[model samples]
Target: MLDAVADLLLEAGYDGLTIDAVAARSGVHRTTVYRRWRDTGGLLADALDAAREVPWEPPDTGSLAGDLTEINRQIVAALTEEPSITAALIAASFRSPAAAAALRSFWEDRYAIAAIVVERVAPGVPARPVLLASCAPVFYELVLLRGPAPGDELAERYARLAAASVSRSGAAP
Candidate 1:
């Protein structure tokens, strides 16, 4: 059912997604979907929750720049992919508080897991800002600014710059 929601979201977008569509897509009965999810927002939130349950871990790339570059590359790929699920979910988040909260929770968990890379940069540094410094550019350029998504090399450049900033700040050697 969650898969159906995701597929429907990708195929038709957030505004076009509907309970009937999801039910038909999944071959699940309408009443069952309604009983479980209640509405489109519920379905979206559950879909996000289901995604969160999937196994994921930040890369252990042997260096802060390497790890951050890998992370940034992933962001670029997700945003640039055809029928981008990440972009779709981000759009969906704006329309539904339930989906928003669920999306927020997903990021919170992702950050907590990814923060270990920052920890390697500085044992006790505030992880979020440092981590954000490395990856935020890709999102800002690709999503917010609607710029052409550059390949992973540009992502690596952002990571190098971020790592240099951290190093210059005496956070790491």
Candidate 2:
């Protein structure tokens, strides 16, 4: 059912997604979906929650730069490869409280997992800004500028710069 929701969300934006569509796609009874999810927002939230359960383990490349670069590469792939789905989710998050909360939870969970890489390298430094610095440029280019998605080389450069900044200053970027 969650898989069905993901597919439907990719096919149709949040406004077009319906309980009936999810039920039909999943071959589950409408009543069952309703009983499980309660409403469209709940269903979407649960679907996103379910999708996020697939853990994205941070790389243990021995160096913070390597780990951060890998993380940025993954971010670029997700934002570029699934632009429609990502955009739909982002739009839905702004309009739907359930989606917004779910998205927040998703990021919090992912960051907690990924923060280990930063912690391992910079024991006393705050990890959030360092991690954000590594990926913010790619996001800015892709989301704000509406430009071409950055490739791995850009990700690596950002990661190296971020790592160097944090390592040298013991401060978050």
Candidate 3:
């Protein structure tokens, strides 16, 4: 069902998505979907929550640079490969309160996972900044510049820069 929702979201913007469309695509009855999801926002939130179940173990390459590089690589792949879905989700978050909440929860969960790696590499340092620094440029390029996401070379560079900044601040052991 979540896959169906994702497909529909990519094909049609959030405004085009409807509970009926999701039900039809998912082959589930409208009543069942309604009973479970209640409305489009609830359905989108639940669908995103379900999609988050994909495995995303933090990297353990024995160095902050390597771990951050891996994280950035994943981010680049997600943004470049699924730009439509990514943009749709982001736009929906701005348009709908439920989507905004769901998007926040999704990012919080992702950051929590990234924090495990950051804490391992730099004890006592806040991970959010490091994680954001490592991937924000790629998102900016994709969204604002309307260009391709930064490639692997840029990912590695961003990772090294982030790791260096944190380490130089004496945050690492």
lDDT of each: 0.87, 0.81, 0.81
- List model 2 lDDT by residue over 72-144, tens digit each: 8887777778646666776788777888889778877877788999987678888888888887876777666
Q: What is the lDDT of residue 53 in candidate 1?
A: 94
Per model, state how many residue pairs clash. Answer: 0, 0, 0
What tens digits encode model 3's per-residue C-alpha lDDT throughout 42-124? 87788778768877788899998898898888777776685467678877777778888988898889988889888986778
Name the regions of candidate 3 deviating beyond 4 angstroms: 82-84
lDDT of 1: 0.87
Q: What TM-score goes with each of the models? A: 0.94, 0.87, 0.87
Candidate 2 has what TM-score?
0.87
Model 2 clashing residue pairs (backbone)? none
Residue pair clashes in candidate 3: none
Task: Give the per-residue lDDT digits (tens) of candidate 1, residues 1-173.
Answer: 78888888998888878999988989999999889988899889888888889998899989989999999988899899998998999999899888999988988888889999989767867888877888888888887899976788779988998888777778775
- Residue 114 lDDT, candidate 1, scale 0-100: 93
